[model samples]
Target chain A: MIVAERKPIDEILGFLSKHQKIMLLGCGGCVTVCLAGGEKEVGILGSELAMARAKEGRPLEVVQRTIERQCDFEYFEGIRHEVKDVDAILSLACGIGIQTVAEAFPDKVVWPGVNTKFLGVNQNVGVWAERCQACGQCVLDKTGGICPVARCSKSIFNGPCGGSQHGKCEVSADTDCAWALIHDRLTRLGQVDSMREILPVKDWSHSRDGGPRKLVREDLTLESGK
Target chain B: MSNGKDFQPKIVAFCCENSGWLAAEAAARLELGYPEKVELIKLPCSGKIDVLYFMKAMEKVDGVMILACQKENCKFLKGNERAKSRVLQTQRLLKEIGIEEDRVTIQYLAANMGNKFVEIVQNMYDKVRELGPNPGKVIK
Candidate 1:
């Protein structure tokens, strides 16, 4: 899932200093799972902001609302009435949700409460690590399912580079060399011969290098006339 | 800072039933004296105390204290740990709003440590007295 961490409270307070009344919008999606921006977080931030403002002799009116998924337009219809009078929106969603809300309410000021980290899996209760770069390519078949693009410091496509030593990457002693993992997995499967096959240069066009990416399903579109 | 005579700071203590509340009860049974300004709100566990509750308490009180079981001694396994994290989060929030982070604190002790409970409350009360009343305390 997409992972994110809440930005520092001081930075958020700075953005809200001018606004007397604001809405704290939360998402029940990836941020919720990661414990960064959810209904609970919304309540925490809202209360903090209110108390902070109250301490300044200028009390702030904060409205808290959490939508099922902030990335979808349908869920936003529920918050339209709540946003009409707020001075700005402090969105506790991933970057996508913030932009989606911005586009939906062009007249309102939208601020991000989280720094979208990466496409990753939860390592533990409060830990997360990058697992995918969304490079628009799937090379796991040849690489023994270990993603070299994200795990490898150099993102090397071939087997262990000269920098790999004792199963660890040269970049850091703590980091496990991605190619070492691939080599070990391939050996276990008796497919070590596949490791000798040289991989071609990765095409950059499919990735962010080309531009913003989008996916469309003509069959799913209402205009498909099917 | 106002002297103790003039400043009667209102302190709210969220006490876990397994340890904190029990300790307070034990202190009372022993005729131990703690600050009367400290009001104890008993809860099933320290983990159940939400940040909203802390913030609301701050609005009406001069300080807030979370009393939980010692690390690894929580009856609910990790209730104290959860409460500790929440306290840290609320402290940062309070600091951001121009309030002293010292106004909020977490004290850990066993149910048998009734004297420790009274000592910690006295310490917090004295500390808050030096800090003065909560500027954000709602007049109404």
Candidate 2:
């Protein structure tokens, strides 16, 4: 899931200072599962803003709403009535949802309430760690299931670099050496020979450097008249 | 509401049923008295109390107190810890809004601590009295 964290309250207040009435929009998708932004979070943020404004002697009115998924236009269509009266919107979704809503309501001011962190998995109740860099490639099969691109301090394909000591990365004592983990797993599976095969230079064109990426399937598109 | 003395701060107490609520009930059974200005809302666990409830209560009350089980003693395990973090988060929000951080607090106690419950309530009442009424009350 995409994990994120709420921005500092002061920064959020700065964004909202000009507006007396605002809408706190929450996403019921990834942000909800990650506990960054959800219905409960929207209510909390709305109350915080209201209290802050009230303390300043400039009372604020906030409308709280959570849609099924902010990234989908169909869910947003149900919230048009709620959005009509707000001066601005504070979205508690990932970057994609924020952009989708901004594009949906071109004339209104929209601000991000959370900082999109990374593509991650929940390690425990409240801990999430990055698992994928979305490099537009897959190499898990060659290096065991552990991802060196995302977990290694340096994305070294053939690694356990000189910096790796006693299965720990040089970057931090708390970090496990990704390559060491990959090597250990591969060895257990009796596939240590794969380690000797030198990998070729990666294609950079498939990543973000290739400009904004998109996926299209003409057969699945209604316009294709399949 | 003033009572011919100094400002009587209105307080809202959110009590966890397993601990704080039981303490309050025991206190009542013993005929011990707490501040009349304090209102109690019982919850299944401290984790159920959201930051919004505290902020909304602040609109009408001068202060809010969240009473939960002590660390490592929560019936639901980690519910009190989650509540503590939420309280800290709310406190920061209050400070950002120019309100005193002391306006909201979370205290841990056991279900059998009836006298302790009364003592904490008294302490909060005194602290809030010094802080004065909530500034947000008038704006709301």
Candidate 3:
């Protein structure tokens, strides 16, 4: 899932210095699962914002709402009336959700309250790490379920670089070498022989390098003639 | 920072029912005096206090004291530890916004330690009094 974390209080306050009344929109999607932009986070941030402003003697009016999700227009439909009243929107969702809300309401200003971190899984209760770059391609079949593009510090296609030392990445001792993890995974699966396979230079066309990507599912779209 | 008036800092204390609440009761029974301006709130567990509550308390009071049981003695296993983590995180948040991080603190104690409870309260009262007042709130 996409992961995000709140921006610093000063930066958020700087963006809202001009607006007295604002809506804090929380997403119940990936951000909620990641514990970043959920309802509880919205409350936490709203209180912080209020305290910050109140300290400066600039009282702020906050309207908080947590929708089912913020990346889709259907979710925003439920709170359009509430959104219309606020001078601006402080979106506590990821980059995509913030953009979607801005696009949904072209007339109003929507500011991001969190920085989009990455596509990752919850490693533990309060810990998360990057897992996928969404390179728009799949190579897990060869890498034993690990994405070299995301895991490996250098995105090495074949195996560990000279930077791999004792199964840990040279970038940081805390980071396990991706190839080492893949080697162990392949060995456990009795597919160590596949490790010799050579993967060519990645096709960057599918990723963000080829500009913004789009997937139009012909089956899912309603036909105009229908 | 002096406003020419006596600075009787208003403190809010969140006490755990399993341990800290009992200790506060003991303090009351023993007549070991604590600050009259301090308000004590009882919770089922210290872990039940959210970061929002801390900020809210700072909005009105000069300081916040969280009283919980010692690590191994926690009735809810890891409730005190969880409260400690939140307190640390809340301190960071408070510091980020220019509030005195020292205004928020957590203390661990057993129910039988009523003297220790009074000591902790008096220390917080003195600390908060020296820290002036919560910049988060204007309690004039």
Best by TM-score: 3
Candidate 1 residue lDDT tens string, A1-226: 9999999878998999899899999999999999899998898778777776776778888889999998988898888988999999999999999999999899999999999999999989898988899889888988999999989988889859999999999989988899999999999999989988999999978889989999888768786443
What are the per-residue Cα lDDT tens digits for candidate 3 across B1-140?
46335888999999999888999999889989988999999999999987878877887788997999988988888999899999998899888988888999999999988999999999999999988877667333
Chain A TM-scores of each predicted structure, in the order given, are 0.95, 0.96, 0.97
Query: Can you tell me which runs of candidate 2 are displaced by over 4 Å?
Result: A224-226, B1-5, B69-82, B96-98, B108-114, B136-139
User: Candidate 3, which CAPRI tier?
Assistant: medium
Candidates 2 and 3 compared by lDDT, better number: 3
Candidate 1 chain B, poorest ten consecutive residues by summed lDDT: B131-140
TM-score, prediction 1: 0.89
* TM-score, second chain, candidate 3: 0.94
The number of the candidate with the highest DockQ is 2
Error of 2 at B132 (Å): 1.6
Q: What digit string (tens of lDDT, one per residue) describes model 2 on residues A107-179?
A: 8999999999999999998899999988888888788999988999988888989999999999999899999
